[model samples]
Target: MTENSEANSPGWFDKPANINRLIVALVSACLVLLAVEAIFGKSFYDDHHPAHFPIEQMFGYQALIGFLAFVVVVFLGTILRTVIRRSEDYYDR
Candidate 1:
């Protein structure tokens, strides 16, 4: 290797990689979003929170509602999944 070649050459990794900048940008974006939510009082946690009852008092209601929601979701998923299962190897003679 000549002096001109070494002088003109990019040492190992001289070019900037995009991934580090992208990861930093994503982390900054999430922090900004959290900061905005903290300032504006808007949060998914607050939105999905259950009713205004104490921990001990609402256990039964929470359990009942949760069980109902679970049943409904499971029923819906079962119906949807059965639609795909109905076409099992029917075309093979």
Candidate 2:
């Protein structure tokens, strides 16, 4: 029957509840990492160096920098694609 076939389908993640649970788990993990870093993280660089700015001492600074860099790269890639993308037809000669 149609009901039996539907019940026997193997798509565990096809439900909205499963997707929500996955999102919650991932967010919870990120929060835990952030909390751990905030409580126990230490700078790896020398204190007297110019590179060791005060703002850099804050927790999650590296993550912020990485995320910003990723956004910049994606923006630049979008611009490059517009400049270098080929036409749909060039072999019609």
Candidate 3:
């Protein structure tokens, strides 16, 4: 991997500044969406769009549930990994 070839490579996010820019862009997008929801969510929900469950009417409920689901999936994946992991000497026998 010579310096010139590395510079010509196409890994845009390999640089620290690019990663930071990506993070900033994503966070800004989320904040903009959150602001839009905060300003419009109640009216949008109330305009003949009834929730299936009573709890769904609460603010930030969907975000909370999504985060909880993500946490549960990660936790289960960790446990599953430990249970199914192969020993280092698995093929040496």
Candidate 4:
């Protein structure tokens, strides 16, 4: 295709996003999750001490753990790639 044809081609806005539907879906998911937690979070919010941590803390810890795990995985990948890297024609005669 020519440059003019490519330039006229559709981008993301060619199909507009449903802002209202997205907002409604997001709100509904949050409400459902909150209801589920309220029903099953009794034990976590029962003990009048460290055991009585808020659900928010659990979410925070989960996020922190995921980020740390991702960082470790990425670091290991970089190290391995560097250690095993070779020229593009290393195997060619």
Candidate 5:
């Protein structure tokens, strides 16, 4: 790719330092959110939930669940890819 084309494309996040900064920023934001939730307590909807699950009231519970779900999805997708993928030359015959 030419310099001009690369410049026009999304190259801002291509650097390792940029990616690290992004990760740090996201983690910091999550920590701040967790701190706020701990100080202010749950929302009205969460407070009035039918089930009294202890884990639900924990700080960062939603984030933990979301991260775990994402991990599971990625893991499953990797496994499924190996199972369903065919040889590149399978259709050449």
Candidate 6:
């Protein structure tokens, strides 16, 4: 790669500092959202249909559920990939 080509490249997130900034921003946003929920979740949301199960009312329950759901989906996707994957030159014939 020539200097001209490298200079022309527009890789905004290719730098480690940018990646770290993005990570920090995302984590900070998550923490802020959790704090908001902790402060007003019961008064704002639970008034409609209060959860009977004690575990459902715990802090971060929704986040836990969402994370677990994502993990389950990725796990299923890996299993599906194993079932559908083909040999590298499958279409060369």
Give all candidates' CA lDDT scores: 0.55, 0.72, 0.74, 0.61, 0.73, 0.77
Residue pairs clashing, model 6 = none
Candidate 2 per-residue lDDT over residues 44-74, each given as its tens digit = 4446754447887777887788789999999
Tens-place lDDT per residue, model 3, 1-93, is: 222233445877479896686668767876786777688876757647667787877777767787799999999999999899898898897
Task: Give the alpha carbon lDDT tens digit for every residue of 1-93 in model 5.
Answer: 222232344776688786686678777987898788787675623444643788866777888999999999999999999999998998896
Kindly report which residue stretches of model 6 are placed more than 4 angstroms away from their true locations once superposed: 1-9, 46-56, 88-93
Give the C-alpha lDDT of model 6: 0.77
| Model 1 Cα lDDT, one tens digit per residue, 1-93 | 122232344543344563455557666865686566456442323646633645424324444676689999999999999777655666773
lDDT of 4 by residue, 25-93 (tens): 666866786666666764644455554345445643544666689999999999999999999998994
Best by TM-score: 3
Compared with the true structure, model 6 gives a TM-score of 0.67
Q: Estimate each model's TM-score.
A: 0.29, 0.60, 0.68, 0.38, 0.63, 0.67
Better of 2 and 6 by lDDT: 6
Ranking by lDDT: 6, 3, 5, 2, 4, 1
Pitting candidate 2 against candidate 5, the one with the higher TM-score is 5
lDDT of 6 by residue, 9-89 (tens): 478557878668667877887799899988886674556777778877788888899889999999999999999999999
TM-score of candidate 5 relative to the true fold: 0.63
RMSD of each: 15.9, 9.0, 6.9, 10.9, 6.4, 7.5
lDDT of 1: 0.55
Sequence-dependent TM-score of model 3: 0.68
lDDT of 4: 0.61
When sorted by TM-score, best at the front, the candidate numbers are 3, 6, 5, 2, 4, 1
Candidate 6 lowest-lDDT run of ten: 1-10
Instruction: Give residue 67's lDDT in candidate 6 (0 to 100).
Output: 86
